[model samples]
Target: MRKTAIIVGELKSRYSVGRALQQNERTGYI
Candidate 1:
């Protein structure tokens, strides 16, 4: 259970970072 929680947290952080990067790129290009 603890390992699963850690994995979930890592995934959430990674997703947020990826989304932010994508938005930044779009804003810069457009």
Candidate 2:
């Protein structure tokens, strides 16, 4: 359970980062 929680947290964080990067690219922020 602990490992799963960690993995899920990492995945969510990574997904949010990817989304932010994409948004930035679209808005010409990067």
TM-score of model 2 (CA atoms)? 0.95
Best by TM-score: 2
* TM-score for each candidate, following the candidate numbering: 0.90, 0.95
Residue-wise C-alpha lDDT for candidate 1, range 1-30, written one tens digit per residue: 999999999999999999999998989953
Across 1-30, the per-residue lDDT of candidate 2 in tens digits comes to: 999999999999999999999999999998
Candidate 1's clash total is 0
Worst ten-residue run, lDDT, model 1? 21-30
Off-target runs (Cα >4 Å) in candidate 1 are none
Q: Relative to the true structure, how large is the alpha-carbon lDDT of every model?
A: 0.94, 0.99
User: What's the lDDT of the predicted structure labeled candidate 1?
Assistant: 0.94
